[model samples]
Target: MSDTDKKTVIVFTDGACSGNPGPGGWGALLQWNGQEKEITGGAPDTTNNRMEMRAVIEALNALNQPCHVKIHSDSALIVNAFKQGWVDGWLKRGWKKTNKKPVENRDLWEEMLTAMQPHDVEWIKVKGHSDNERNNRVDRLAVEASRKFQQS
Candidate 1:
């Protein structure tokens, strides 16, 4: 949290997929000053992690101004990437993994980094399929969105 003056925004995000590389969707819910907004998007063919990251990317992009953000998500991979310094290491290595393999979802990773630049960001990992209401809502939103692609 860099700026104390920035308004605090709480966000819940989730992603869903019908198949590993099939129809996928991502959802986000943003809350600020007693108001809330929901956003969702779907891809015809994608991975679950990419959809997960997309939820974060879209949520951050929704902010019109720089703010302190707390993002609650069920994805440990996304949370740990930021909280555990994986993003920094990946950057230092030109987006390569420790084994020198190219990182998966590099495009979304780049966009997420850019969308995050204006905010003081905190990633919170939440338990999936648990009792978190907002998280569950976003999950349903993601699943519902992906259902459209599932039929096609």
Candidate 2:
């Protein structure tokens, strides 16, 4: 297959927070054929979930156009939400859980959905703090980004 026909992008992402609701950071690595990109950012006050979602958001947004994407993340909340059809159900219920409680990060979820709309995405769960090189790299990137805020 030629490069044009090979439009799949592979990504690995991780999020870290010093405290549940304290400074947080997100890291993402995107690989497409011969090209690779690493992206990271931090927030003064944010939850781990938000950072996790942000890693995906940033990665998807980095794409220049629609393409098939395989996303690897260590967050079960995110991986399960999509793989288990929870996200679909949430959208069907107007972003409410089965108990009718509003989603905690509706804005981020909505953003993720929008970022994902133009692409075919597959969410893959990776073991966190494991020996996976890319996962470990992103995890360190996230922690380093988060600690930047702690030092400030």
Candidate 3:
């Protein structure tokens, strides 16, 4: 099919951490039309939430054109923040909580918004270990990435 025919895409992402604040990794799969792409990355030491946000940011950034995008993630913290409209509140309040602390992962959030700016994007929350094949693949890739970091 032609490039214009690729008007919609599906993305699955997952993050893994050896410890809450230890080696971490992120993985994503993007499918458009009949084509598929996979992405994975790791950090020597990080938090799961950071990796979670990174997964979305990296996946969105990989798109070559603005398309209707459906992003699925298993992280409630990331999914709820966007789906519940809490991200808007955080943005309006200058990335600070009501208690006035700087928002965690603000950098990744900014990157995600920037990457998504050209696309119509929807965020969906999926149960991590159920029947979703792509999600399971990403989860395995993420864990593997994290494990590589640990091995080093």
lDDT of 1 by residue, 65-150 (tens): 99999999999999999999998999999999999999898999999999999999988999999999999999999999899888
How well does candidate 2 match the true structure in TM-score terms?
0.93
Better of 2 and 3 by TM-score: 2
Q: Rate the local accuracy (lDDT) of all candidates.
A: 0.95, 0.92, 0.90
User: What range of 10 consecutive residues in model 2 has the weakest lDDT sum?
Assistant: 1-10
TM-score for candidate 3, residues paired by index: 0.92
Better of 1 and 2 by lDDT: 1
Off by over 4 Å in 1: none
TM-score preference between candidates 1 and 2, better one: 1
lDDT of 3 by residue, 46-104 (tens): 99999988999899899888888899999998888888988899989999987889999
Pairs in steric clash, model 3: none
Residue 119 in candidate 1, Cα distance off native in Å: 0.4
Candidate 2 lDDT over 8-125, as tens digits, reads 9999999999999999999999999888899999998998999999999999999988888999999999999999999999989998999999988999998999999888898999
TM-score of each: 0.97, 0.93, 0.92
